[model samples]
Target: MQDTASQATRKVRAAGLRPTRQRVALAGLLFAKGDRHLSAEELHEEAVDAGVPVSLATVYNTLHQFTEAGMLRILAVEGSKTYFDTNTSDHHHYFIEGENTVVDIPSGPVTVHNLPEPPEGMEIANVDIVVRLRPKRR
Candidate 1:
């Protein structure tokens, strides 16, 4: 079986990003755990816990780079909190309001209709839907 480091290297390179040591390490952390969402602070804490020796600033830069390279999707929640989603496919999400958790909505369940037309000479990009969830009050 391929190790995590080499796999991260390949993944990063495949996404048109140069696999530096720190990038490879961060990529391993981001992709090794399967698809999930995390903020830069969370990832920085994980790096510290894993002894990766990376700064939060570097983590932010790396995540933005990865996002630009289409390796990740960015989700904005709670007005100021941003989470990076590892899954890049076309899908919606469920954001748990108080818990700060993000859950993937199955691909076929949610359907959107009646989108407004874009301005002249502009094309519509993919649509993103974030369904907020909270505990039902009894």
Candidate 2:
């Protein structure tokens, strides 16, 4: 069986990324826990906890690079908050309001209907639906 680092290295290479030490370390943390959402700050903390010795800027850069390379997907839930999703498949998400977290809503559960045509010379490139959820008040 391939180790996590090996798999990550292979994945990065396959995605046309350099697979540097920092990228590999971050990839391990991102992919090891399976499909989930994470932010650069959260991932930087994890890297520190794992003793990866990476800077926060490096984490942010690596994440953007990974997303561009099709290794991950970016979820912009709010103007100030952004998340990195390991699951790149066509699916929606549920944003927990107070908790500031996101969870998958499963692809088939939500269906978009009657999307308006894109402006002239432009095209619609997929839609991202974020269903906001919060605790019910009594």
Candidate 3:
């Protein structure tokens, strides 16, 4: 069986990113558990728990790098919360208001209708749909 470090190294290289020590360590943490969403601060905590010895700034930078390399997706919720998603396929999400968490909404159920064309020289990259959920009234 391939070691986690080696797998992370290959994944980093395949994404056109050098598998630096920090990047590899972070990647292992992010990918070890399979697809899920996480925030920079949350990942930083996990790194510390795993004894990775990385700063929060480094965590944020690595997450952005991975996102830019198409290895992750950034889901911006509300004005201040941001979540990194490992599943990059086309899909929507449900945001739990009180819990501050995101859950994937299967793509088959949501259908996007007409959207206004982008201005000249621009193109539509993708549309993000986030359905907010709150606790039911008593």
* Top candidate by TM-score: 3
lDDT of 1 by residue, 29-86 (tens): 9999999999999999999999999999999999999999999999987789999999
lDDT of each: 0.94, 0.92, 0.94
Query: Which parts of model 3 have CA positions greater than 4 angstroms off?
Result: none
What is residue 22's positional error in candidate 1, in angstroms?
0.9
What clash count goes with each model?
0, 0, 0
Judge candidate 1 at residue 134 and give its lDDT. Answer: 98
Question: lDDT per residue, candidate 2, 1-138, as tens digits?
Answer: 149999889889999998898888889899999999999999999999988999999999999999999989999997889999999998899999989999999668788899999999999877999999999999
Q: At residue 72, what lDDT does model 1 achieve?
A: 97
Model 1 local distance difference test score: 0.94
Error of 2 at 115 (Å): 1.4
Candidate rank order under TM-score: 3, 1, 2
lDDT of 3 by residue, 1-138 (tens): 249989999999999999999999999989989989999999999999989999999999999999999999999997988999999998999999989999999769898888998999999999999999999999
